[model samples]
Target chain A: MSMTKLTLQIDGRSIETESGRTILEVCKENDITILTMCHLKGITDVGACRLCLVEIEGVSKLMSACTTKVADKMIIRTSTEKIKRYQRITTELFAAERNHVCSVCIANGHCELQKLAYDVKMDHIRYPYLFPQCEVDTSHPLYVLDHNRCIVCTRCVRVCAEVEGAYNWDVMNRGTNVRIISDFNTPWGESITCSDCGKCVEACPTGALWPKAVVQGQLNKAPEFISDLIEKRKMKL
Target chain B: MRVRKAKKEAEISKNDPRVKFLANKIKKENYSPGSLIEILHTAQNAFGYLPLNVLQYITKALKLPPARVFSTVTFYHFFSLKSKGEHTCLVCTGTACYVKGAQAIVNELEKQFGLHSGQVTPDNKLGVAVARCIGACGIAPAVVLDDEVLAKVEPQELTQKIKSKLAAS
Candidate 1:
């Protein structure tokens, strides 16, 4: 099958690309920055997090760059004032939704969510703190599931099902009440399907899922590792 | 306690006629994964609420991951994982109803019965809940008792009315 050629302008620069690639991919190739949370390169994109929204010239609403395909002759603006404002608000909400005390978190400086807040210049949250009674599940023996720090990006859910093929982590409930559950809301140590792989721990953007071996400020995760593995697996050799 | 709970759940799945109805519905739908919502509706209707065993049975019958079945069930408000009680009082808290003193009625219920919305009495006789809207704005301040919609309800009379309903059955 031959790849279809297309022309598009991003950030006022004329670029030529092939079809079947997302706007985010085109932006990355050109060194344009697009913020995202629920996107994992190896697996599918659900566009759950709205951080990658970009303003297309003809479109009325902002489109998520990770999921929106690059069309012919499209004009896209990735860093408009409106997009920045929305991104800041989104970052603020993530902070206020649960208890994310960065100073005490396991991932601290290494956390993607904390880094996102710094990038967006989110100093103080305007939204009310939900202070929901979230759970900290230490039943896995090897890992911990802390609901307080989760943003519900479902990165762990996707990576577990797609990369690890364990299908152990899934979200339950909706809105502010939602939570990641293991096999019928059972304790992680009691899961019948989990292979005890730590792929989910690495895929987690926040300190929501972490290995029990690591303490506060000692955590390191490489989501890019999953993407790299996928690329190598696709080789014919 | 965990073992006991599991055993009781197994007993229900083994003996309940409702489980048979749910199984029949699943079979009729050919156990297609696309029919998940429909099967869940049948299961909810037959069982009055979705239990763990019923969800597990559906998951097995459809050959789907337990997580998938659970996520679908929790996404929709129409399905309840817990019982809505023997009798339910659903107050409409939509704009029109709120303007017509729906909050007052809710407050009255909380004060009188010491049970907030989404909560059932200790005896499990009556459950209190609130709806975004019941679409009965023509009769704002509507409350649904069981399946009957009571319109233009007063806050002071709600407790008495609920008590009477509970006493009936």
Candidate 2:
């Protein structure tokens, strides 16, 4: 496949990247590490997390790096106080709604959300905790569910349907009540069509789903390696 | 202005260990709110948390108004203006993990810790939190134990892992 080259300014640093690369990739490649709760690499960009928001010189409102592609002479600001505040608020909203007790969570040490909170220095959540009670489906022999920890990034939904071709999981409901559900809202293990490949669980970034063997504050999932594999595969093609 | 007055009160004491450390690393030149997050991060690393006095010191050093600093600090999830538990756990509840029983793992942890998600244990030994995604979805039902990744875990295994960590500590 032929590639096009484009030049853009990220955080005032001018850099050139191939065409078809999203701003998130460019930023990551450049070591910008934009605050992102969603927009995983190798997966299609859904811009649902809204944590990677940035301000373009000419654009009025902020834009999500995952969805926005770089253009010639485009100027971007990823770390303005305004942008940081926006990202922080989004993170806080996610934390307040669910149970994000990092110390006890399986993903404590390696969790991106926890890291982001640490990175942002969010000591206390100003808002009240919603503690919205949700179901924990452990019927799946390999994994368990903790709805309280979900931030609804939807990487699983996209990866399952798009990357895995299983389409076994999907998000039901909308807004704060949204959650991932199996076929006909059945238990994950009962979903006979599930490949048991464990791709969806691997795609999750939080404790919403994890192998039964991994305890809370002990689960660690790494998608970077998968993204690297996908990148290598694309490069080969 | 309200912002300016807040800035004046946000100075840090020179004798404080965190302030001295920041003073040495964070030059008094070319400060901005954009770098505020980074500065706070450094301070937190050095001081465990961003105390009110530290905020004042940062406001004075960075030449940012106290309200502006406070606002910026409050806006990001990464910066904690208050004290946090010695141990922190982050659970990923993203789509992939959700379908794989991430919720059950969190529930078990909550029950064991006697602290709900996003809360500090009464003894302040641990803090529990949930995040949107950690970019590690392929390891469904992922959790981070103080910065380590334990992927593809089961509920019983999760308990054992925690028990062992506590035992080791």
Candidate 3:
């Protein structure tokens, strides 16, 4: 399979990319920052987060850059006020659920969700917090449980079942009460078949599955160097 | 008969102090309804588990009521309000780890321990869990035991390592 190279314009910058690459990838390669929650590097793009919505010239509605592959002569705008408003509202909706107390959370400083909120300048959650009932499974020794921090991105679920093949983690319920669970909905500690590897915890973009004993104001996240490396590898391929 | 009674008595004492300590700690922190999850982490570290009383304390402290706290605790995979065994073994089953036979290693460990995933032995000596991706995919099939990483573990090597660790502990 060969990919044809094509030139496209993103936010006024002209760049040449492969025919089948998404606009998000094109923008990312060119150092453009687009807000996204559901986009994971080297994994299938679900466009569930809705944070990567971009205004394509001639498109009827805003399209998700994650799912929209680039075409020849395409023009895109990523930062119009309209787009910012949409991004802000979407971020607030995420913040409106569970608990995102940045001051005392483990991922306060280093969380991607927190950074995204800061990027959009969401000083307060305008909408009332749903505060859905959620459980934290602390059966695993190395990590802690805090469901309130989850944004329902499903990155952890996809990485665990699809990428890791353990199928140990999943979003068990639906709608407002949805949450990530382990085998037969058992406690993580009770799942004897679980490998206890902490991959899902690491893959999580928020403070959902953090290391045990991480200080409230000092959660450290692994850098995005690997994601960048994966992107580079995909481009090379 | 006396030995059985003593064992039961000792178990109660072992579980009591940790639970009481967590309850007091959560109270000291003043974790409110909105901040229950944040305090849950603190409780996990202070007690090595989230006991029933600690959850009750959180409900009362946060003013969230009981059912709400219970539902939240059951909703996330990361929360553990129960007691765990002495040792924990986690295998990375991320994309890189999967391609590297992390699954096979997990299976071997399950067999050797005479336990299934998420179960502790009757002796309560060890617990096993699996993670999706630990971001260390470069070293596929990564396994972490008590904060130490064992990379590129073959099936035979894994069994031997677990045996040695269990024996030493």
- How far does residue A146 in candidate 3 sit from its true spot (Å)? 1.4
Residue lDDT tens for model 3, A1-237: 589988888889888888878889988888899988877786678898999999999998999999999999999999999999999999999999887778778787888998898899998778998877777767667776679888878776666655555656666545787776664455766542355666667777888888886777677765354355446655743
Q: Could you give the CAPRI-style class of model 1?
A: acceptable
Q: Residue A144's C-alpha lDDT in candidate 2?
A: 77
What is the DockQ ranking, best to worst? 1, 3, 2
The 10-residue segment of model 2 chain B with minimum total lDDT is: B1-10
Write down the TM-score for model 1. Answer: 0.89
lDDT of 2 by residue, B1-169 (tens): 0111121334556787767878775675356656787788888888767777777677667765443455455556777755567777778999999999889988988788776777886766777788889989999989887789989978778778766766776
Better by lDDT, candidate 3 or 1: 1
Q: What docking tier does model 2 reach?
A: incorrect
Superposed by TM-score, candidate 1 places the C-alpha of residue B26 at a distance from the truth, in angstroms, of 0.6
| Candidate topping lDDT | 1
Name model 2 segments beyond 4 Å from true: A1-3, A229-237, B1-169
TM-score order, best first, reads 1, 2, 3
Q: Report lDDT per candidate.
A: 0.90, 0.76, 0.75
Q: Individual DockQ of the candidates?
A: 0.40, 0.01, 0.02
Top-TM-score candidate index? 1
lDDT of 3: 0.75
Candidate 3 chain B has its poorest 10 consecutive residues by lDDT at B1-10
The CAPRI-style docking tier of model 3 reads: incorrect
